[model samples]
Target chain A: MSRFIEIVEVGARDGLQNEKVVLEPADKIELVRRLDACGARRQEVVSFVNPKRVPQMAGAEEMIAELAGAPGRSRIGLVLNERGWDRAVAGQCDEANVVVCATDGFGIRNQGASSAEQIATLAAIAAKRQAEGGPPISLTISVAFGCPFDGEVSEDQVVAIAQEGAALGLAEIALADTIGVADPWTVRKRVEAVRKVIGDIPLRMHFHDTRNTGIANAYASVEAGVRILDASVGGLGGCPFAPAATGNIGTEDLVYMLERAGFETGLDLGKLIETAHWIGGKIDKAPVSGLSKAGPFPKPAE
Target chain B: MSRFIEIVEVGARDGLQNEKVVLEPADKIELVRRLDACGARRQEVVSFVNPKRVPQMAGAEEMIAELAGAPGRSRIGLVLNERGWDRAVAGQCDEANVVVCATDGFGIRNQGASSAEQIATLAAIAAKRQAEGGPPISLTISVAFGCPFDGEVSEDQVVAIAQEGAALGLAEIALADTIGVADPWTVRKRVEAVRKVIGDIPLRMHFHDTRNTGIANAYASVEAGVRILDASVGGLGGCPFAPAATGNIGTEDLVYMLERAGFETGLDLGKLIETAHWIGGKIDKAPVSGLSKAGPFPKPAE
Candidate 1:
């Protein structure tokens, strides 16, 4: 059976947040231009957080204003609290992503809140969004697989949080392997369990290639009926709080596998690789994508 | 259900062959000692070939004779022709692995023989082994997934070769993604097809992490009920002939996935990572393994 998979491009937001080099607003806009040229219809373009704490993400409002009102593209803004949520709504983001950590250790460190506080805040944001009528909002459960500070995260913890998140009537819900400690079998089992709790809500998956299991986890999620996956161009981004955490699965690498297996990902492989190298140059880091170095199959006829 | 899978380490031979630095026989032996320390029961320690052709793979005779007849370890010698096969038999290798290229383009460049000629050589060697009662022989179909020279190797091509190889009463048959171009879905289908042709014979898989699909491909192979997989320490190895080809799947990386997924791989993940770093130091190259850089999960109490 032929399938269509949506890869939510995260290179502009999650990708650059962990980079040592900060991109200016114009450069960030240029990066989004390349992503749009590569046929990315949905992208996580900004995180509405304290720029003082994360200087790399200082120009979210500027980038969002410049990126506003793309006809077909949906620009998502990640907001962890009500203040950030207000900033996202004020910025006219196409979508808002709410992140709730599965463990208190990661929650306190990453978002300056506890797991229970994040869930309660998710409820408040959903209620406010329902009354105020802003852009669509989705919930992402971070550290659903494992946490760097708290050690192993239990599926039961993630399931309970997903069950609560599903009750909020959001657009979609994602399970993020924030530390990249997920295996395919564990991913399949967790996806199946989380599906039982969140009925009819589109399940998205976010993975890091920290232990080289990101692609495999993505494959398992797809096989388990997850349609939306988060990827970064050139495998950019890492968890600054999570020790030794690396970049997300490369968008071109994911597209390469999907297209080769007869799945339509609505992505151009040549352009993706080209953009990967382009972003790597912009960030002054080598692209961690395999397709960039290995090149596309069939040798490109020359 | 619980399961047991075997990982055949290939660091010493395949892992080192593509390195720019040529290792001495003593250093190669030191590498094997590390492999043995990591509880690798089966390893492709050496390849019998012309030293002039592959200088990195020289001193195979000395290394094999020194490592002859380990109590529980099975040292496999890779042989491409009748002459190498004779050398394998003389070296008292625990097992002999004969390689037959899936395409004529690769067969000529890699082994100086056509596909049909390699099959003929396989048949002759099998007959001689049957008459002489030497070490057990296995067949490996190199580039079973894709060929760098020919490109897009068909499943029918591999299945036909596997059918012939199975008919020769070999120990096991392996499909090598020599250029690391295979995807998980394709791997499952091809493994099923090859299994139908090669009845009851064990199926092994060798993958390179060239395009970052090796772990995914290995997970697919195990799910398809293929027990044996080939990995190299620190994810070493590349194709001298194939442009931009990189390392195999890291033994530590594979073990981390399998052990986390509850499959018995009988490998020490810690030792594998240590060996990856050790070999990288010996060769003066940083390991390509994610685990070497990311470290193991659960924080290791540090």
Candidate 2:
């Protein structure tokens, strides 16, 4: 097992996108800045997509542009198409993350494209990014474990998409339990399948705490040799397309678990928790993170 | 891995004991009956503690009397002393669970006895039960991972308590993360240490989701070959002795994870979720169980 794990902060993009209240560009920038100051080395600061489709992400370009040349952190931007990919590169994103829906049902519902069409678009974007030769690209297979519209997603389907991404020479490929419907067994199986196809490509995991299996799945993923995990600070995430989706795994809670399990995350837990509390208050609600709810566990005497 | 896992439904005792509002004795009996009807094989129905100390458990004898000879389930009761043990047997409890603290501080505060004194009492009770041949006793070590007063509890302390219980010929031994301070690594290490001392003795696990690692620890326990898991319906549990100690692992949520991970728990997920919702409504609140919140994961078409 790796002694260290990299946490990709996604609260600014994925977490806030699902919330009912849309924060101003300034708030989004400030949230990312606070996270960075608290040792967030890599983060999803924005998503370059159609504002009409996702109004919460209206000022993605502005958010990224404002954070460009910032100190000590790498900014990632979510892009779903060639156009969005172009926008992310223009805005100086350190990494461009493209998501392909695993099942056709979710692809159509979420992105208005079939799975094949989405894969084709991703292939074009990958080619363009490879030619551009600066901002690295990564692929996230959404609803890889299970889809709401399509109940059971086959491992073969997920691996097929991963293979497409691997062929593009993407830096990383992530499997997202978009609807939080994965057990550890499924997580292990899917991760193994994807790894078998994409031999040396790094794998990341995205999980939601909707059914309360997110932490368990995360642990399973870690045991399966996954190193990069995407989490929201306050567990602030849900699916706009998938019905009844809830929070992503809370970053503070995830960090607590990882650090206790002997994985060095290099993030200050106290500061992260305070950040969750602050943002939750600014949003006029309690944070959904369980560790935030439980306060901090007393550290064992060294 | 054991395909079949034993879930000891603890809603009636551990679940309700932590709630601020007390339920009527009849309501408690009805809760146990419903759990049994939903195929719960073993349950902690009530605790035979002093009514004045814990008024919520005021009707332990009456509740057990009402549940005595109830069909299709084994009822267990918590007993702290010889008096409580006598009451449990008289109330026709199928098993008596006695908790011995792993640290002196928690023992003094929670049970008004040192760890040594508690073990001595348990040993005497174990002798009597062996001679009488009924109502098998089990020992639980609270704060087996870390204690609130004592910062770090030694593995030797936990192993020592398990050794004492093993010498007493207890039917099973459970190590409880009383304050939910255990990580998966600690759980695996502790379970291994205890197993080394008490070979072939059935080991049970009790986890509080206080620090949000309960489900993760439970998964690790299962991977470490643990079969019996204790959980509360609706996540209804908190340690009255340990400040800020929160709910136990939610039974419905745990069952969902286990069954999906290919462990057959012999539990009706739908019925258990319905029971959670019913009880939560009866208490005029929503259930904390995640499965009850998200509804069941859609089963694949056979």
Candidate 3:
């Protein structure tokens, strides 16, 4: 009944960014269009990074140009530094998602900076975008739950970064469980801690289903008052930087949990599963989504 | 560390009972011995059921007798009806686990009776066991969280049934998430409801990892004051009667969560995983445990 929950689809950018096989720009555009038609108002369509480092995301500008005339969807581009931000701005993307890792190892590996420097850089980018009257920007703190390098990230560290992002007037602050090691208790505690520091700021959760606790952790976050969630269609995304990092929480699976728990997700789970199935066919690998394999709950009697 | 948590390993019985392939009685006895040597104080050895319906549990008598002589371990046997109870008593089991389904559809399929009839039968068996000075008996209500046939089992119904079991002076009561459809909220609410009705009766949780929420739900139950848990070694068990029901939550995986969350499980997770791997080899399939595949959290840097 309530339409408060926002499903920020991140499959196209975060999901496809690390693939060994590069997709054509036209194929990326078609994927965005399909997600929009399936009721995704916000989609992370591409990442603005160097072509040599991440060849899969090399055609970000071209893909953006293809979808520039497409209607009814807000396309967000993920950016790592000033150069990436400039690329996103020139591409005329609707939003920019800047990330700052909670630990030094991941921050350096992901963005080649210390945690403090990364936060400072993200804040400067947010400020610069505001100064130029550019599109809105949001900051996501990755490895907020636990880091592959630094285990058990403290809530205080996450809160401090979120507060800094809030001070920069960021659109939203999301806590990313980059490695999928967070349990429900950790999720609830971290989300609550961040909420205390960034009062009234929209908070989102990004979870990976590495250990199969992703959906449960997401539900725990929802109970702790999180509304926006980041998921990959068919559980497609994983961090190429973090060792053994698995797929993000599948969008279809998340929708199933939300709708069945009496929350409105504004997405068709059956259609989402079908889309995941279709995408899996294209990728030539079966998805790891439980709902796709197990089907919905209260299975019809034989 | 507080050694308060006890994991009742049920793979030998509840886990093996549902398999389509029938294992030899000698193999079953060897599995029980291996689990006991791994520090499982309580092992559910076998189920005394009709061989025509459940061929896997056909040698319950011989398996129970062999496991009863096992050094320093309590051997538990499952019984559905009064006939099964006769077999358990004849086998001289250390404990008898009586089962009653929370909903009518599951009750008929599992126990061939209505909920009321099942409750009455369980109460009568408890009273008779006490009067005869037989072994201590524990009652576990299957589908306590939700039933595959009936969606959304009410907390009131579960509490009433728990009260019925408590009135019979059952040594313990376990609530089973028969179909793996419960979230953390559902687990907490139901456990709290049953706790309110049956004061001071030790509560146990039997969960399956079919939908990947099993360990999280178990954590929630533990937070809600349930100390005893049922886990299948290597995630072995599922309900043969419940269609589409997958493996139970793995004991090694459960222990990992408990120990990491600062709860003392008194079980060595690495040894448990090794035991699971060994058992999996015997069964001709890899164990369905995530921790076995992912390794423990906070893995040492390479």
- Candidate 3 docking quality: incorrect, acceptable, medium or high: acceptable
Which residue runs does candidate 2 get wrong by more than 4 Å? Answer: A240-245, A299-302, B239-246, B299-302
**lDDT per residue as tens, model 3, A44-156:** 99888887888878788888877653576789988888888998889888888998899998888878999999888887897787678667888889988888777888888
Indicate which candidate wins on TM-score.
1
TM-score of every model?
0.98, 0.97, 0.91
Which is the leading candidate under DockQ?
A: 1
List model 1 lDDT by residue over B1-302, tens digit each: 44888999999999999899999999999999889999999999999999999999999999999997999999999999999989999999999999999999999988999999999999999999999877899999999988878889999999999999999999999999988899999999999999999999999999998888899999999888889999999998876544465689999899999989888988888888899989999899888777887888876755
Q: Which stretches of model 1 miss by more than 4 angstroms?
A: A241-245, B241-245
Candidates in descending TM-score order: 1, 2, 3
For each candidate, report its DockQ versus the true two-chain complex: 0.65, 0.55, 0.40
Residue A208, model 1, lDDT:
93
Model 3 RMSD in Å is: 3.0
TM-score of chain B of each: 0.97, 0.95, 0.94
Instruction: Judge candidate 1 against the unseen true structure and give its global Cα lDDT, from 0 to 1.
Output: 0.91
- Real contacts recovered, all predictions: 0.62, 0.52, 0.28
Candidate 1, after superposition: displacement of residue A275 in Å? Answer: 0.9
